[model samples]
Structure formats: structure tokens, C-alpha cells
Target: MTVTPPPSRSAGRVATAVERASSALGRLRRGRLLHPAGRSFVGETVIWGTPGPPSGVALLDQPGRYRTTVRLSKGTPTPGSWPDVLGLALRLHHDDGRPFDLLVSSSGAAPGLRNLPLPRRRFTGTYSTITCYRAGRRRLWLAVLADPDSVDLGRSLATAVAATRTDTPRLVLAVASAVGPWRLVGQVSLGAQLSAEEDAALAFDPVRNLPPELRVAGPLAWLRDQTYRGSRRARGATAQSGGSTATTV
Candidate 1:
């Protein structure tokens, strides 16, 4: 995959404006810009040995397994009964002491309306991403596979306990590692449920934290960091205020 050049001056200006607006919006909400409240889970990921041919990217070239943590939530400050974006954030701890984080939102449930503001069907099961990234000359994406019914409980504090099941949740990342076929990598299993406080402290900044091999070079890449900065600033401000970083589910 050819690397797209960085954003131009005009695009930079627009990104800056969006970031500022996002920060303002977060302050107004007095919480995270998105997925402010969520249930946490500890799990693990296991990459298949024959995942695919060598991808050139070191992370995906070899098969491996690791521990992971996940946060499941509705993208908006609403109840699960409502139609809204579903969210899944993951943190994978590799054996080499590398921690990779991923954040994904559910797509529209209907065909041709994937871009619509529809909630992801069956919040508890699977999550995939159409967004592609450049790894050297290769392009890739990621996915997290799970049983949507793994925890069918509602989005309430009481129901959050259901996520801490005896079975550990695993992270399944789908990456188009090589030119051949899209393969899954970085599978990690989740363990326990994190307390509200612990969840609040965990942050996923893709641009800042993504591994160098997973180089971001698509047309929309420039906007990723800018868009997230607003939320990061807002979250920081909320924490400093000693306010509830997340709304009570």
C-alpha cells in the first residue's frame, strides 16, 4: 500500500477546529467525549500459528497470545435500550511487555447504511473495523470476535457484573497483514472486571500508542489524533475537577 502524504495546511486548520470543538463538547458534557460509562473485562488473545504468510510487519509475522482488558459501552450517554453506537476498547499486553490498545465503535446494523448512526446489532458479540492502515507497503484493519450473547445483560451497574464470567474474553484483531488475505492477529484473553475508578484511568490513543510497524497513512489518518485530543483534554479536566468521569450506568 502506498503511503498517503500528511494533511495539507487547509486540512490541518480544519482538524484543529474539530479538535477544539470536541474538547468544548466534552466539557459541556462534563465527561468523556464518547463512551463515558462502560463495563470492563480482563481477557486474552491468541493468534493462530498459520494466520497467514509473512506480512513484513513484525507484530503480525509470528503467532502469539497475550493478556488483555476490554471496556464495553454505549457510545452515547443513554441506556442500552436506545439505538446508539456501541463501543469496545481493548488493551493487549504482549509477552515482550508491549501493550497495544484498540478502540472500535459498532457499525450500522442495516446494509448500505453502515455509515448511518445506527447502533451495532447485538452489543455483546463481535466487532469489526473497515478502517485500513498502512504497514510498510501493506494495508490492514482489525477485528474483535466474541459471542454477542456472551453477556446479554442490560447496561446497568448491576448487569455489569455479568461480564466477569468464568470464561475469559479474548481479543481477535483482524489485520490485512499481507497482500494475500486478511488474517487475525494479537488475540488476548480478558480476565476480571475493573472497578469504575480503574476503567476511568485507562485511555486508548491510537495515534500516540500504535506500534511503528502499524503505520497510519490513509487519507483520513491526519484527523485521528486531532479528533481524540479534544476528548483527552476533556477527560483530563473532568478528572481534575473530581467529578464523575463516567455517568452512572
Candidate 2:
């Protein structure tokens, strides 16, 4: 049996701070603290083995296709076409019927910058997990990049919403070691937009919804878990439902 260590005092303090901040922000906004506004889509994820070493997580090491619900949002409520840190929240069902959520934000793809969030005016940029996940004894990072062949939609929320009206948007999923180049793992194709009510009811929690093989550990994970709990509490929302009724195209 493996015993997990308790979080450090400093980690506890940081978690508390993050929780309080997220709660306050959510209350002030009367909804989500971070991605206050967003468009939701029904989609699918197609996964396959990468070229490099396996991530040790069965989901990434094997081939699979899963239904997904995705949300695209601006981190800050930046007005109109202004640049803002973008966010992507993806929810899918594992083979065992558990829901797995992955939250990503606009970030760099290169080493030394992959963990840093960057503002963008278009939806066609890189989005990263911004934190590490433990896959066995190795640390891994995940990213989603816009498919170069896809349309380069404009910055405004309206543009993104409108584009989905006519066509589906696609993003390439990749994974990497602590400092290695990214290896292609899968693809996410977002289809029809979800209704406002459906979008409002959806809450993503990657920290709680992850698989056993891919553990979210350390201070950053603690902070994120607390922050997510606080946000949901302030908004009176619960974890995402495994059986989503949203319509897909």
C-alpha cells in the first residue's frame, strides 16, 4: 500500500488564501469568479498512443473515443475584442463511468513558459494545464493547441459563438514530460453550442475528477482544489453530472 503525505503548513495557508479569494470573487460576480462568461459545446475526444513514452495513464496510453462537453471562456471579463487569458474546460466520462474533467487556460507551449498564462485575442492559440500531474513516478503536462487548418476565429465572444453556428472547431491535444517536447495524443472536436441554462448548470473540477493513475499532487493542486470548492460553494453549484443531457450536433 502507498501512503500519501499530508500537505505542508505553507500549502495549507496558500489553499486558504486561494479559497477565500475565489469565494469573494464569485460572490462579487454573482456567478463564476474566473471564467464568468463562456460558451459551451458538445463534443468528442479521440485519443491514441503518442509517439514517445507512454504517460502511464491508461487513458492516454490506449486508443479511445469519448463524448465530451467543452466550454470556452475569457479568464477576465475583458470587453469586446480585447485580449484576455482564455480558458477551456472539458468534461468526459472514463471507461469505468467516472467523470473526468480537464481545465486548461491560454499559455505558452515552450519550456520555461508552459506554466505561465498568456492573454490572447483569438481562440486559435495554445492552452495548457499550467500545472503538473503525477503519472507514476514522472511529472506530466497537457496542452491543447488550435488545429492549424481550422478557421482562425476572431476574439469577441460573439464571434466564437457565431462560428460554432456553422462549423465545428477542432483542437489538438498533446502531452509532455517535465521539460520534453510535446507529443500528440488526441484531438477534441467541439460541435453545437449548449443552451445558457445547460452551460450554467455545468461545473468542472479537474482536481476531484481525475483518474487514479494521474494524480494531481503538491501545493498547486491543493490550492486549485480549494479554489474550485470555494467557487462552487459561492455559486451554489455542484460537481458536473456524468450524464449530461445537452444536445450535440
Top candidate, metric TM-score: 2
What is every candidate's alpha-carbon RMSD to the true fold? Answer: 5.9, 2.7
The positional error of residue 231 in candidate 1, measured at the CA in angstroms, is 1.0
Give a tens-digit lDDT track for model 2, residues 58-168: 888788888888889988869887899989888876656667799999998897888899998887888989988888798999899888887655687788878777887
Overall lDDT per candidate, in order of appearance: 0.58, 0.80
Tens digit of per-residue lDDT, candidate 1, span 1-249: 123435565766777788899899978987677788676766565656436466566655666655556677777647645656777776655445446667666753223332234464355444544355666676655555554434453444335455455444344565543233435565545456766776776666655456557755555555666667788787784211221122111
TM-score computed on alpha carbons, candidate 1:
0.75
TM-score: model 2 vs. ground truth = 0.90
Off by over 4 Å in 1: 1-7, 94-98, 108-118, 147-160, 177-182, 237-249
Model 1 is weakest, by summed lDDT over 10 consecutive residues, at 239-248
